[model samples]
Target: MMNNYNKEEIEKLRDLIKDIDTAMLTTSTPEGLLSRPMMTQEVEFDGDLWFFTMKDTDKYREILHDSEVNVSYAGKSYVSVSGKVEIVEDMDKKREYWNKAYEKMLDTSYDDPNLVLLKVNVRSAEYWETGSMTKNAVNLFKKMTGSDEKDPSDMNKTIKF
Candidate 1:
């Protein structure tokens, strides 16, 4: 069973990543880890991240073989989330996240049987914001001085769900 997430942390994480539209999804493979760029579903995140994929794709097979995954996003900030994925075939959910862009990119409609949703139950996330140079320099100076105190504007943080 999934543990309850802190609402504040969930909201903070959602705000940080909502603007990032694409993510690199990494899945475990027998050989090693495989990663591919996937379009993130434009829905409010509440400890779960969603992506669309084809049933026959390598990612789908990979998820089946090993559910553990990592999703990384880059923008003004960089975020990496660790999670486990579950294949979802709910048509309502597919339609809810579907859009013309997906149709054009996938060359299929939401009703396509091959199209499915990968619901990633996020376990934890680490993020780093690209702060102003002054803040970064100060942080670097603090690190160099071996200061254990964290600045309120510290660029990096980890959130656990």
Candidate 2:
């Protein structure tokens, strides 16, 4: 399916997730779905998320078998992004995202042949945020009074990119 993203929606998404540093990246595997915590790249979001991984990892193999994946983030709000994974081997692009943290964690430089970048082209996202206590209480009062009004939780939204 083609992603139809608007600037406002994209910016909203970026705003929600910009402060979060880590996300659980779920990839389809032959056995089942596998999820692992991955450090999210700090670059400004533009419908894509990037991660650094070695070529020989299980996630890499899983991505090769099935590109479909889900990435989830949690903080003040919860966000789940569904997308396709693209394994990038471009040296320049790799260098652009490379940092000291990666060098320390992976014990490898950006020039390492085994290092690869996984680019997730986000297709859609669903986010849930807890509303203010006042709003929640108002929704509760409405429900108790038999008012057919939407609950505060109903504010949770799903946006298709």
* Prediction RMSDs, each to the true structure: 2.6, 3.2
Residues 1-161, candidate 2: write the lDDT tens digits.
22457888888889989999999999998889999999999888889999999988999999999999999999878899999999999999999999999999999999999999999999999998867778768777887999957655657899888
Q: Report the lDDT tens digits of candidate 1 across residue range 64-118.
A: 9999999999987889999999999999999999999999999999999999999
Provide the global lDDT of candidate 2 against the true structure. Answer: 0.90
| Clash number for each model | 0, 1
True lDDT of residue 153, candidate 1: 65
Model 2 misplaced regions, further than 4 Å: 1-4, 132-149, 152-154
Q: TM-score of every model?
A: 0.87, 0.86
Q: List the residue pairs that clash in candidate 2.
A: 4-161
Mark the regions of model 1 whose C-alpha exceeds 4 Å error after superposition. Answer: 1-3, 137-152
Give me candidate 2's TM-score against the actual structure.
0.86
